[model samples]
Target: MAHLHCLPPSVEPRVSEHMPQIIDMIKQIIDSGCAYSIDGDVYFSVDKFSKYGRLSGRKLEDNRAGERVAVDSRKKNPADFALWKSAKEGEPFWGSPWGPGRPGWHIECSAMSATYLGYSFDIHGGGMDLIFPHHENEIAQSCTACENSNVSYWIHNGFVTIDSEKMSKSLGNFFTIRQVVDLYHPLALRLFLIGTHYRSPINYSDVQLEKASDRVFYVYQTLHDCEVLLSLHNNVNRKDSIPPDVKSCINKFNDEVLVSMLDDLHTPVALSALSEPLKIINDLLHTRKGKKQELRIESLAALEKTIKNLLFILGLMPTSYSEVLQQLREKALKRAKLTEDQVLQKIEERTTARMNKEYEKSDAVRKDLAAVGIALMDSPGGTSWRPAVPLAMQEQQVVAV
Candidate 1:
């Protein structure tokens, strides 16, 4: 997680540590009469809150359809949930106004959040499955605890699923972060997660992850190329003017990335915006027409700046492009189950084949290398190689464990 720069929260308070505040919150909910006590157990009454189902859009009736008949019929509604549970024979107990009991699961969030972040806050998030009984009960309890208590926004991210079913251990389909990062880069996983919109379900497959890994390598590769070229010609050419098309591509890419991100965090569209500018940069660096242009260096500089800035906003930029490239290549080599020496040896064989006028043999070697993600670039100087996105044989070639 640190490799991807996802930081920990500033506050990490536990519900047990905040028992006084939790008890105080239960007292408020009870005072509001939004809750009821029975035999020292407290449960929030859904009947008291008319806006109980507002966030989940599950009507009170809709929640009761498939539920098992309530064992404890003392509850007012089937959807009503525990605020505090009376201590059983052998459980840890906290002193509260409702006797020796501990906080229930739902009210712990409400209590802790209200105490720390206050009753009303900006954003709350949870899985879609939590919408019905968990979050609905929270709203019933929290809003009634204090006047004008509310959450401004509730963001629900889609579940990561496999074969159209939610990824689960009992289902025999679950991939952990440690298992995934062994086969692919961490940023690749992060990129794949954001490739789809936040609200849409994204399927998890070896194939999809491979594509994302390739995309990450490509972006890092392009950045490395631009950096090298920009440094190679540090002095900008004043005699030539920047091409209008370069400027336009930069503009469109910038606008699309920002606009798409701002519009409900539509990240997939922002990701698409990367293709045009990347193509232009690569074209300028390698293509014949682009090399002959008067302002090639100027164009590269502009595009690189635009790309680097946008990548920062997307959290896609690595601390060092060269390091990222090297790391990804190492991972690719592992995926292919081939060492660096083996790859170089193949390149040598290909070079010898081409030198001896064995075109078929050379082509065959190139194809084999490509199958393992080694891309050979033929230049006037020599046949150089770079790592491209590896083909999806890693599932078999490399065990994720």
Candidate 2:
């Protein structure tokens, strides 16, 4: 979670720590006649739970009639699943009324969840695939153990794919977070992850990640520019009243972003809402008309404050934007197999070539720098170099702030 920049859970109840609770719940289910013991093994009767397949919207008969899974002879019904398994050699065991046994996979989740979050939690989330046997069984087991197992909302996120194909180790498409961050910025991957709606299938590709990195860089650059421009002004006090246009934009942000967030965590829509305000901020910063306006400093200040708050709320802001850019630059340098000294040497060569009217050599130097993921932007002030991610799909790849 830390690697992904997510906060630790409020309660970290280990399943092993809650073994007694798990055992009690299993015994309670058995006592309620929802589960049965046979040859030291316990199985939950799906028929006893009338809402067996409710969570998954699956019919019991349809599940039983499925052709793929062969019926276990030990089970009372085809849909019946294990609650506990008898102790096996070279495995850990817990003492139970049904003799030495271990709890099944689904029971541990229900037990820990009920122990910490309680029987009636607000939201229970997992992958969409868990909706079937895993979650369905959890619902049955939890509700059976406690009469008021009111899990208000059950949310499931879609799976991630690699290059539009299902990610599988066997297919040589599996990637670890550490491996990915070693190549690109962790926030780049984070941005790519949240770029789409939670319920939508996200395709992971180098190109998409490059685009996400660019978006992150653009926001940082904008923020840094705002910081510079705002620093030039001595009056840093908050304005009594912002421009009507700025006020309207902020109100719209609350309406579009915060409200959508409340309405089922519509992150994609919330992210999209930022685009307009960010463009407005950039316009105010860059254009002469915006600079000449009376409310220029005030508007920029308001925007800077608002944007930073929004990014923090969304868990998108870095502790230091400069640090993020630095890391990206370091990674880009390594990726290009170039060091700081080597890059400086190349830049000096390029500058000298340009100064001596060696146009061909200067052009070649520019190509060499670009090949190493470095873009040179020559402004009236000076020539500046930054790590450059590919600008393919330029139209689609907007700086979605």
Candidate 3:
């Protein structure tokens, strides 16, 4: 699954591995008089932390009236949170000076992060729901235990909704990443996942996935065509400068895409910025029409390299160009309900009909193939077939009509 998603270093830190450090931090907070113990359990005193609600923007008083928080009279403040939970029968235990108990959920993260990433980190991210008590408590615990320990950015991403409803197992609307990729290419799922701003809620639907799949096909299809053109023009001796418009397109991609990504990880805008460069390349590839001079081979190579680098950064098109195009063609064939052998047979029959001067039969065959979404192109080299509708685009048009 990690390979499929192209994730990097997906390692989980076990709280049990840092039990002593957690116990020490808890002791440090208690000795600082910011926390207290009753019987065997330890709870942090929220009243001691003057900036307690700074992260969540909710005062302790606000939480005091909130129904979601569980109030315990044993704590000094109603907003006080547990740091160490005393062991119960049949429960996991780690020996501490206070008693045999385990670290609380928030404390576990604090201790593990401090032990691994030290007192501070650049970005701390989680779901929007965690902005409240969970993250708020982590900040409170970390600040009290370690000096200058703080997150530079508290990045919280929005949830995925199914047709405007929150997806849940009990609701029976939940879909796993594996299930999603099973139906669509992993890149399509990746594109759908990042199609919106990270902080904005994303709605999941088959239509959206199909559209993303189609976009992926179009992107790779363009890349494949660019590769073919560049292969013919990959000579360094041509030594022609990049055309003005093409250079402008590349500059815009570099400026817009990179700047958007750097500005708070605005990937949606960055992905949208890709369209300008792609359109420019497509126009150039189709013909040198508008320009007085054609673009040199080096210029095409540069454009191809620029786009490939951008796609690499987005974790798309990891395979060789030919391999990706082959996969896309196979997918397109399945969508058109046609196999390679069937397509080949039709092409052969059309060739035979053309050779016999059976123009009507050949034309009829072409029309039939077109109806099934197959496009046949005859060339000096031979005959080749590609799906007439680029999958998603065709489906979208049909729906529109």
- What are the per-residue Cα lDDT tens digits for candidate 1 across 252-356? 888988899889888888888888888988988888887897688888888888878867776777889999888888887887788888888988899999899
Go through the candidates in order and give each one's C-alpha lDDT.
0.82, 0.82, 0.77
For model 3, the stretches where C-alpha displacement exceeds 4 angstroms are 1-5, 288-292, 331-401
What TM-score does candidate 1 get on C-alpha atoms? 0.92
Q: Write the per-residue lDDT of candidate 3 for residues 153-254, one digit (tens) a residue.
A: 989999888888877788899888877765566777777777788898888777676667667766777878878866675454666578787788788888
lDDT of 1 at 311: 72
Q: Which stretches of candidate 2 lie over 4 Å from their true place?
A: 64-70, 234-238, 391-401
RMSD of each: 3.6, 2.4, 4.1
Q: Write the per-residue lDDT of candidate 2 for residues 2-45, one digit (tens) a residue.
A: 75688888887777677799889999999889999999988999
TM agreement with the true structure for every prediction = 0.92, 0.92, 0.85
How much does candidate 2 score in TM-score? Answer: 0.92
Write down the worst ten-residue block by lDDT for model 1.
392-401
